[model samples]
Target: MNTTSHTVAVLGAGTMGSGIACVMARAGHRTLLFDVDETNLGRGLDTVRGFFDNGVRKGKIDAAQADSAVANLSGTTDLGDLAPADVVVEAIFEDLDLKKETFGRLDGIVSERTLFHTNTSTLSVTGIASGSRLPGRVVGTHYCNPAPLMKLVEVADGRHTEGWAHDATLEFLDTLGKTSVVTKDRPGFIVNRFLIPWENSCIDALESGVGTKESIDAAVRGALGHPMGPFRLLDIVGMDIHKQVAMRLYEQLREPRFFPPPMVERMVAAGDLGRKTGRGFYEYDDNRLFGS
Candidate 1:
């Protein structure tokens, strides 16, 4: 992909997908955000608008800039429209098989030179590339949640991912105000290598009744100097996502430390999916929690 004037396509227009699309568009790149579901496509647009509105309200961006940013971004439910894109980044579900299928199809649709990126957190980039027609072109451009705001994009180089592709992806991410960290395509890579396990252990601590929710949160924030406690972070990350990513890491590494504790599974099963569901370790009052 030409790093200069490439049209970027972000598949799966969820929160992360939309945020990435917005950043690319704001950076003067033509962006197309696509999803198979119309509802999700619509929601993605709403999400982008809401985010820009917040920025405008906060005096971070002017209305004209927000309007132009929105104008540069377009969305669709069709994959055919993505054929002309120079780079296609899949920010869809965390499932390995789904990403593989999407990448395989993108390889056929886009030019062979187009860069394929997966915004996957834990899944194997090698496995995703294994299913692609051009394994060498597949690169991991894993972004944190709130993609437009997060400055780091973990650029993973799987065994099969081409060196050139990694360099190009790192450059692109850098252009979008992201700090790219290169690492081998290992489960959890670097950030999550330490983070996910820590969060999982915190859940175990809570499940084991180590302390009350408020006490745990206060200790971490006040004593540990953390911006947010593990449970609060999990609530923002969503309980279901935490459970799934934990399982993926545990299964890949076969390490018990990475295991999603029973508490998480039980909570997800109970439908208390953190902030989104208005409850998890703490209950949400109008999406804002009162007591921990």
Candidate 2:
């Protein structure tokens, strides 16, 4: 868990994984981004490149700095290629059994000292770690969506996670210029615990005809001073992902507020998966919300 001179491997080359890899590379780590599919790995690499390109355009980073950061990132389709990493962060789908199976497989490939971090917002860190051979080394480093821009990184300790692992994760996040908050291994950590329920309530409101999606979003933004309303946030989070998270939290806590509303499930079933799918509670075109 030395912050300096570490090789980091990020599994799953989706939005979160790509953003996490970009953050690590920008922080001067030699980062390897991996996905089972070559196309996904390619797309993840493209996302990292796009982030750097945008940084340069915005004057947040100079050309040389962006170039160096981009150079620090590499992609691989082979999980075996991750053995050289000092730390491995899994940013895959938010399925408990899938995460456990992934860690179980990695246990045979990675070194005993290689710290395992799961970027899960809802699943139990203890459950994921229990499948690992080095359970004490497994920690939760839940980065907010769009990891490169978001400053908060929630670090959680699993039931078997060692103190050093927790400390090291905080230190690592600090090196990446992220604010790390320590929380117990629980459903939704902290932000999602409050945020997801609120989102579900918003959906409920929409279904009950209390407000139009845009009107509700505007009301929350104007009245509550939230940058984005719950519906907009759900769109950003993806309807499918929101449903999964709500379902998991509901299953764990049995709270009605955590249950996904019927509209959410219907939208997900319709493949209107927010920005990624061009529609959700709202429609989108070329990543921009339609008409705004």
Candidate 3:
């Protein structure tokens, strides 16, 4: 594992962005969480700090370690501020053009050897890499939600990705205590291909009166050995996001299993999106967005 500290920049200040920044900081990297919106940037910084502070609260880490990790993280609005970053991980909106444009702009700001990682759950890595002059450095790094807690990360090399960049990305991820799973640069990669359909089926079970969400969740945890049940996971993922991802996959692969059930549409339309909205398959006391 690499012991040398590196400067890392995470674009976008959403749930995924904050989580990734937290991981980098905890690994002793100088992490800059960037966003164009000042309010989002501030919120993201707070979220990153919260992860460390909460770790100390739960005794997952010592106070000094939490404090040190927080100290290593910063927030920025200026893109040029990331010039010194050795690796840039983007967790922005799921817009192909915007993703491409960000990479294109970043290519000129950062070093030629800097790795460009896109945490895109949908969309093509090859398509995103097209925007970069250094396409060889662009790789798809789809981090699981709650990036700090999730051990698995799906890595996909674009058509033009260089072996050096791919190897370096794996090394960097290892330093952050992540397990990298190499996959083809296809839509949904590996996790979503299985996750979306399974989630939809779980929702189906609830709709068909098979069992209450709680009972079903419990059964899955006991039988399938999953950390959390589908409903609970969907609540964390947000109903709207799940619906969007499901619909997109269905449209692309024409798979019936990828289709979101009617309950998803109803919940989304009613603004019961998830933890961010304080409700989904379940309710939360607070409206704060969870990791991813």
lDDT of 1 by residue, 1-292 (tens): 3457568999987657887887788777788999999987887777777777778888898999988888878898878889898788888988888988888887778898888888888888899888788899899888876577667788887778877888788778766778888887888888887888888878878889999778888888998887677777777677888888888888888888888888888888999987557788877764221112
lDDT of 3 by residue, 29-98 (tens): 9999999999888878877877777788888999999999999998999999999999999998888999
- The lDDT per prediction is 0.80, 0.85, 0.89
> What CA RMSD would you report for each candidate?
3.3, 2.7, 1.8
TM-score of each: 0.87, 0.90, 0.95
Model 3 scores a C-alpha lDDT of 0.89
| Count of clashing residue pairs in every prediction | 0, 0, 0
TM-score of predicted structure 3: 0.95
Q: Candidate 2 residues 1-292, lDDT tens each?
A: 5667689999998868988998999999999999988877887788788788878888888999999999999999888888888889999988789899989988888888888999997888999998898899999999887678779888888989988888888778878999988888888899888888888888889999998989999999999997677777677677878888888888989988898889887898899988667777777665322112
User: How many times do residue backbones clash in model 3?
Assistant: 0
Model 1, which residues run further than 4 Å from truth?
Answer: 1-5, 208-227, 281-292
RMSD versus native structure for model 3? 1.8
TM-score winner: 3
User: Which runs of model 3 end up more than 4 angstroms from their true locations?
Assistant: 1-3
| Leading candidate by lDDT | 3
Model 1: ten consecutive residues of lowest lDDT? 283-292
